[model samples]
Every structure is written in C-alpha cells, then in structure tokens.
Target: MSEYYRILGVPENATAEQIKKAYRMLARKYHPDMNPAQDAAENFIRITEAYEILIGERKPPQTKSAPQWSARDIARERAKAYARMRYAEFRRRSDAFDIPMHSLLWPRWVNYFFIVFALFFITDSILPKNTIKCDFRIKHYKYFDACGKVYHLADPHTTVEGQPTGDIVYLRVTPIVGFASSYYIEGDNQNGFLHIQDSPTEYIAAMYVLLVLSVLVLRNKTKKFENKLLIKFGMCIVFVAYLFVYFIWR
Candidate 1:
C-alpha cells in the first residue's frame, strides 16, 4: 500500500534490496536504543510493521481498532518524517568525517609547530630586548672571546671600545644570535656572562609545554604508528633545519 511504502520511506516500485536498505536505515535511526526522541518508539513500531508487510512476513492490522486519519494529515506527517530522516543522514555523514580547524592549514603536528613558532615570535616581540655585558679579548679580526665564551662581533669595531683589559675585554653579550636560534645560546663559551638582556628560559619553557601538549593530543587522537612517526619526523626536521641554519651556517 502507499501508506506502507511511505512509512518505510521507499518507492512502491522499489526492489527488495531497496526496501530492505530503506527499512534498515530508518530502523537504525528510530530504534529505541539509538534514538531517545519522544516519538521514536512509536515511529520504530510503524517502521517494523511496514517492513514486515512489504516483505510478506506479516499482514496489515485490521481497521477495527485503528484511529481514523485524513489523507492530508498522513501526507503532512510523512513529509515531516522524511525531512527528519534526510537531516539525520546528513548529520551522520558529517560527523563521520568531521574536519578540525587546524587541519585546514596542515596536519595536527604541523599546526602545533606553526602555533608554537608563532607564539614564540609574538612573545619575543612583546618582551623587551635584553643584553649582558661581559669581558672579552679580541680572538681575531672579527671574533672575540669573553672569559671562556666566544662570539663573533655583531658590529666588530663599532660596538667594542678602546683596548682590551689585558687579554680580556668588556663587551655586551646577547645569546642565541640571529633569527632562527631564538631559544638557544649562541656563544662558544658556555660560562661567564653579565645580565644585559632577556633570559630565554620562559620562551624555551613555553615551547616545551607546546611540545608535550601536542604529543599528548596526538597520542589520544591517532592510533597509527606511521602517523606518530611522521609527526616525530616533522619535528626532527624542524629542529635540525633550525640548528643547521642558525648554528652551523654562522
């Protein structure tokens, strides 16, 4: 009957496969276990009844106990039910492949990298530049050594004044020179320096926090070992390239 077909959301000429598919899809959506809507149980009963009748598994109920319903009212109800089913199907498909905002730019790991890098630059710009005054002796024409720490003169003849104090001379120290080594120390000397500039400890700590958060999020969200490996590889490349450009290139 037209009413049975409408209840199951299938065409009257639909094949057995189409009828079964439609029934299953609608059943899953309206099933009491899956949907908690106020009328879900009633809709589920109708779906089952329609399915049984269409498949010749059961006969339609007698009209003696059935409530009288006008054709216009039935048509309106069918239209509403079909609209709800269509909306549910669209929502299910959307949820199955939900895309994250960060994924628009790159993978999660790359997004983490860019976010942390951007924060570093932003904080660096906000914080006042700091410098440390230290004693250095001219090691070469452009190179200088302060205590055991060695650095190339940023302005050579212009920044340093007068003569060296014996073999040692006083000069301003700014660690992690150049654009890429923002979080690392620059000079060859590991010790001996005066406080003149901002300490990189906070910036480095922020980066570490970002790294740990990214790792935790990735561990929870991704199950594939290859994906984890790719993320690690990308991080390694970022570090290696940073070091190579700023530390080795100089």
Candidate 2:
C-alpha cells in the first residue's frame, strides 16, 4: 500500500494541523489548474487520498507482505555499520591533538602575560632609578639582601683599605618592576672609587625561555599523548633546567 505519511510529506507522528498544512501546500503546488505538468493531476489525487486516510475520512489500502532478511545479510549489514562507526571515532581521535598555527607557541593567556611582562621590563629598564643608600653585606660571597630586596653583584670582591670590603653602598631601584639594577660604593680618593653594575636581564630572558619550553611540552586540550614516558622525562628536564638557570646559571 502507498504510505499516507510519504504521500503527504509528513511524519507519522505529525499533528492534525501539520498534516492539514502539508496537504494544503502540496495541493496548491500540484493542482492541475495551477501546474500544467502532466503528473500534477495524479500527484494532487494521491495527496487528497493520503489526507483523507490520515484524517480518518477513508480506510487505508491493504499492505503487502513484509520483506524478509537472512542471518548472513543482517550480519554483513551490521559489520558495515560497525566499520563506519569505527572510522568516525578514529577521525575524531586523530585530530584531537592538532594544534593551530596561531597557538603553536603559547596559549592566549600566556601570550598576554608575556606581552605585559615585556612592557614592564622595557619601561623599568628605561626609567630613571631611585637610588637609596643602604648597608650591603655579602651572603655566601655571591648575593646580598638590602632594604628587603635581593641583589646579585657582578663582582663581589670590593677592596676597602686594600682588603675585601663590606660596607654601605648605593642601591639603584627601578620604580615600575622594583628591580635593583646597579650599585656603587663611596671612596676616599677620586681614583680609588668602585662602581659595580649588574642587571636581571639575563635571568629574566632565561626564565622566559624555560617557560616557553614548558608550554610546548604540556599544552594540550585532550591532556593526553602517545609518549607517556617521554612526556614525563621532558617535564623533568624542564624542571631541572629552570632550577639551574634561575639559581646557578642566572
């Protein structure tokens, strides 16, 4: 039998209003007087019959025997469906880790942070420093903390009266980033004066390099990778490198 739903172009669960609307639209388009096509009259008759049967105005036509399916045919169809499903899943997983070109180096937030830090670095480096006279003492013969700020000296060996000196010195501090850029010590004779200079430029650059490496190693939306052991090893390497650069190498 002809499917009433297919003839009216409406689903089986279509509401009465929906079926009526579909019948009206199709009838108007396929009416013999409106459409001069030869099949228009036949289509209009079919839609009219479908509308009557669906609205209980007439009895439905008798249906034919149902098509039979063998076990082998069903299994073959299932296997084909399974293969298609697996292929779709494989595509999704394969492209999960594909990083975009813009975010290849760093994420959006990280990029913004780098820009702010660079601006601060440049502004602090250019602006005139606020020099404060404070008593500087050598700690482990490498660095000293003065006025609640740490300073790494370029040359720790300063002679006072022809000996290793530890005395009050000028602490040059920048306003923006509050970095202690350089320092100088007073001398009795004009020729005996010492002005040692050091900056955190190298240390800051090293820190940024390490941060970039870290982002490359760990950045991913899926939080997964094929090389589990290699990823952990790379993270360890980054950690060790950061420590060495910040403490010993900086």
Candidate 3:
C-alpha cells in the first residue's frame, strides 16, 4: 500500500490540523498555477489524492483490474517537494536574520535620506530669501559667487575695470529663489551693482502647487478621471520646469 502520510509529508500519527496544514502547504507549492515544473500536474494530483484520502472524502481503489499507483511512480515528485520545502525554510531563516535579497538595491534608511533631502530643498525654495555675506574676489575680471560660480561683471566699468587682480571685496548678496541660481549683488562698487532675475516666479509657484496637488491625489482614493488628470498635470509641470531650466534660466 502507498504510504499516504509519507506522500503528504506528515507523520503517521499527525492530527487532523497537522494533516490539513501539510496538505495545503504542499499543494500550494506544487499546484500547476503556482509551479512551472513539467511534472507539477502529476504532483498536484498526488497531493489532492492524499488530502482526499486523509479527510475520508475518497477511498483508495481496491479492484484488481484498476491501475495501482505505486510509490515508485511518485518518488521523484516527493523528492522535488522535499527539496523545495528545504529551500523555503532556509530562506525564512535567512529573512529572520535580516538578510533579505531586496536589501541589495538599497537599505530602508537610504530611501528615507533621499526623501529628507528632497524635502529640505523644497522647503528652502518656499521660504523667504535671506541675505548671505561673503568676501568676494576678482578673478580674471569675473566675480565668483558664494557657490563658486563665475559671473560676468554685467557692467565691467563699475567693478572690475582697473581693479587690482585677486582683490578681495566684501559684499552682501541676496539670492533669487527658484530662478536657477540667479543673485543680486550690492557692495563697494562705484555704480550700484548688477541685479539678475528671471520671470519664472509664476512657473515656480505653479510647480509647487502642482506638486502639492499630486501628493493629495495620491493620498486619496479618487476616480479614474481625477487620477489621470493629476498624472497629466504633474507631467506638464515637469516639462515646463525642464524647459525653463534648460533654455530660459541659464
């Protein structure tokens, strides 16, 4: 007689709960829908037959003319199931040790760090402008801002003309927010200083508003039309920002 308990991977004296649990776990592991093995259908049938017999839902064939399913017919299937269970148990143990495979992409803290970085920049842009004081030096008739970016003298006669090379001049600077790093400089120049600003304040304000709207849309369960609208609006903001930064803001 084929050992039903051995085929289902349960003890001979296993309780009803144990039998059911074993049958279900093995069935899910070998079911044709979940498994792609060539012999998955055969193993699934064997698992079902074992469960039915244990539950008293079906009787084993007893007629001599009926085909008998021997242990040899399912030995390979039993071995495959056992190997898969062992692998699954190993993975579970590894997961318990916090060694999951997905950590290869990035740890949880790294994702949080990037989120905080983005929020910091956004908040900085939204806040009021602040004055930054720094000692400026003339280099090759150009001025280097606090961020080390060089700018033309706008009116060379006002500052750089006849000025000693590498002269250090103190200046108070105000940054123009959301306008691609443009700044207003005022200091010890014969003429008042050069002021550079762009007309992207409206675009910057609209982008921020769209970003907030997209967040709200994602948080709520909305209709399909609203979801599509949010996506389109977000894309438009991104495209406009790209155009302003690439062509106008430089």
Candidate 4:
C-alpha cells in the first residue's frame, strides 16, 4: 500500500485530486505512445495499477499459484493487444509518410504513374536531338518570337547587348515529349540560352518531382483518420477565403 503511494508520489492521506494529478503527470511521462524508452511501458502500467488501487477502482488481488483470470484482467489484456496494434500501425504509417520517392504501400496505378513520369523526363533530358535554326525577332524585353514559337531569354538586359533585328535562334526540341528542350541564340554571349516562360525544362521536372512528393505525403495512412477530417475543414476555409477575395474583397 505504501509502495503504491510512493509509485504515484502521493501521500497515503492525499486527496483524490492529488492522486489524479500525480497519476496524470506520470502517465504522460511514461505512456508508450509518447515515450520511446524500453522501460516506459512498464512504468506506465505500474503507475496505472497504483492509481487504480489508490482510487479504490481496483483491489490488490491476492497472489496465488495458477490464479484464475478475472473479467477485468481479460479486458486489460485485450486493451494491451489493441495498444500494440495501434503502435505497430503508427510505426508503419510514419515510415511510409516520411518519404515520397518509393513505398510498397502505394497502389499499383500510383507506382506505374511515377515510373512512367520519371522515365519520360529522364529520357527527354538525356536523349540526343537535332537543332532547328530559325530567324527570330525580339518582341519584348523578356521574350522573342522565333519560328512561330516564343522563347524567354534567361536575362534579356545582360544576354542582349542589343536585341538583333533578325537573329538566328537554334532550338533543340526534346526528343520524347518536346517538353523542356533547350534554345540558344547564335552569338558570342554565353547567356544567350532561351527557355519557355514559367515552364523551363528544369522547372517542369521539378514540378513533377513536387507532385510525386505530394502524392507520397497524401498517401500517408497512419494520420489518415485525422488528416481527412482536417483536410476537409482546411479546404472549406481555403475555398471560402478565395471566394471572398475574388468577389467581395477585390
């Protein structure tokens, strides 16, 4: 009896509130879900048992050989099993959610999609392609028209001492998807390389990578129950805010 009080760090004459406070503090420090120490689980169970006994919710059973299990004991065992299952789920989910590059948890379609997208970008960037030469005219400080296509200069002010009225621009269209190919003006300047505005090859590849990572994070299942609820709440707020800004605030 004295040992139980000591375990909870409460006095024998301690009030119910004091006992509860002590139990809660110890539980938070030792609960298996919060604490990773090997002894935390044991300490948590001990503190819980002590708290129950001190609160008169459970009696100290007499020790004997081959003691029959009570209904309460059965319930406790079931609860422990449930806790273990939840812990395992937490571990598995945490790992899966931490990385987006690859995971077995992803569906077949998702895996295939990632593979196809990765292959396309990799092939596009690596494969050899012929260059097309076209006469170009600088339409604006930022971009130029070439072969019926618009190409944004990397730095118009620095790259162009002056925009040539009829400059020859060469284009290396991507072999696979014609996406993110390089373009350059035939000149002495090294920075005469041109790209599509807001959609450079590097930017396109990076956006796809970001999409992959987002998918990985969204696929996280451990926090699924809470995240789904939160996502719904968050999306509602975002949509409402967008509508307000577009229709009323503006």
Top-scoring candidate (TM-score): 2
TM-score of each: 0.31, 0.43, 0.37, 0.39
> lDDT tens digits, residues 1-250, model 1?
7899998888899898999999999988987668999898678767866887789876654454544544444445556555665677689767644544334324666756655764564465356544443455667655555546554544323244622234434443233342222211235332343332222322345445445545554444654545555555555565555444334424
- Pairs clashing within candidate 4: none
Give the per-residue lDDT digits (tens) of candidate 2, residues 1-250. 2388998888889988999999999989987667899987667667776787789876554333323444444345445544554576578776654543224444556544544444555566668878878876666455665665566655534333333355776766667656666666554233332333455544455445544544554454234444433444544454455455445322
Off by over 4 Å in 3: 1-29, 37-39, 55-123, 139-250
Please give, for residues 1-250, the per-residue lDDT of candidate 3 as tens digits: 2478888988888888998999889988987668999988677777877777788876654435543653543454455655665677688766554432222234434334433433444565666655444445554544454445444443442353544333343332324333333334444434543443333433455545545544443343443544545454564456456455536534
What's the ranking of the predictions by TM-score, best on top? 2, 4, 3, 1
Better of 1 and 3 by TM-score: 3
> What's the lDDT for all of these models?
0.55, 0.58, 0.53, 0.62
The candidate that achieves the highest lDDT relative to the unseen native structure: 4
When summed lDDT is taken over every stretch of 10 residues in candidate 4, the lowest stretch is 241-250
Q: Can you write out model 4's per-residue Cα lDDT over 54-94, one digit (the tens) per residue?
A: 89987764435335755557357446644764677699878
| Residue 195 miss distance in model 1 (angstroms) | 2.7
